[model samples]
Target: MTMRSTMLLLAPAVLGVAAPALAQTAPTILPDATVLEVSAEGRTTRVPDVATIRAGVVTQGQTAAAALSENATRMTRVLAALKQAGVAQRDIRTASVALSPQYRYAENQPPAVTGYQASNSVSIRFRDVAKSGAILDALVAQGANQIDGPSLSLDQPDAALDEARANAVKIARARAELYAKAAGLSVARIVTISENGANDGSNPQPPIYAMARAMKASESTPIAAGETQVSVSVSVRFLLK
Candidate 1:
């Protein structure tokens, strides 16, 4: 083939590939869209449905075996009393069991082992909050010396969390719409949605300093279980046109 013929044939192939590249490099022209991002929280409160109680027995004796034996006997009564008070077997859990030696120290002498002390504790969960205080009295009658807690919680926390999540989305959408309207723009659609998290926001109550030894006050052990609050937050982005 002649030089002119070769040039003519190559020109078409080069132009065919260049055409696709030119189309790819072309800029797109579309309506300018704005975005509105917002974060919001939802909270709900309801009466607590469950209460947890920690109770135990502490015994002392000259020997470790004697101390442990006495503590075990008392702890048996405590467990029985819990059952008698209507606490289910599934709700009762052993927390701890330990035996430690008591020491007596002199000003310039090494410490001497005086005796041994044994402690046994168990945790109980009461579904019926109304009977908690009365049950506590029952445990005291059964020889429980160390008692702590009436820590309150909700039986079905998932229910509260679900409600909060729904409310969070609704509130976030309302906030985004308000901002868009104030800016003289209209919300086209929701572009994205993300859940931050849910938190109970309640601190655990510390054990009472002196209640460990006493079971009942002069009157019926009075207990007040307040409401349980659940909080949820969410983030949303809305396309504004």
Candidate 2:
């Protein structure tokens, strides 16, 4: 080959070998980040703005039709009483209706049906907690034979939950920073946040609530709507510097 041809071939090979090194410059590497994990719980206490109750009637008669008719009549009166007590129609709901045969037992013999029984129930929501007692009193006076829970709750829970969530986040961050500082490190930034659970407390029917069962026509049923607690829990991880 001529010298120029040889030079051209050699130059191409030299440049090809140097291209990889030129592209492979040292890159800046970041140090491993340290993290702190923390968990926190937050709670807020607020009075329930709404209450729910279940009331019903049970009747029996010799015939199925008679028992059902009596139950229907009683249930109609009970519903009217609820409406008069300021319970909106939308808030009153028919929970259940059932008719069953009543049986009598004899020694060493198969039981025989003695009569027919009918039952009807309603679930009511009392928007005004203060008036729930009076409403319950009216229900009893209207001949409600079966009564159940007055479960309490907030009408709208978003605001309460938001407050609780904010508190949880603030506490979680604070604790994470405290732990990081104790370990001779500074908080760099929040790495991740996760919610563990949230709960709005229950309105358990206390023994005192049973007093409504015996309320007289002249007496107002007394009910104590205790405070309800909203709770939130969170887990957080923060970067430590």
TM-score top scorer: 2
Question: After TM-score superposition, what is the CA distance of residue 11 in candidate 2 from its true location, in Å?
Answer: 55
TM-scores of the models, in the given order? Answer: 0.78, 0.80
Instruction: At residue 205, give the lDDT of candidate 1.
Output: 72
177: Cα error in model 1, Å: 1.5
Cα lDDT tens digits, model 1, 1-241, are: 0000000010111111111121133122223546566667778887887888788888999999999988888888888888777789999999998889999999999999999999988888889888888787777777787888878888778877777777776777777677777878777776555666676634247885223445436765666778767887666656677
Candidate 1 colliding pairs? none
Instruction: Score each candidate by Cα lDDT.
Output: 0.70, 0.71
Candidate 2 Cα outliers beyond 4 Å, as residue runs: 1-31, 206-217
Q: After superposition, how far is residue 15 of candidate 1 from its true place, in Å?
A: 33
Question: For model 2, how does the per-residue alpha-carbon lDDT over 118-150 read when each residue is reduced to its tens digit?
Answer: 989888888888888788778777778777887
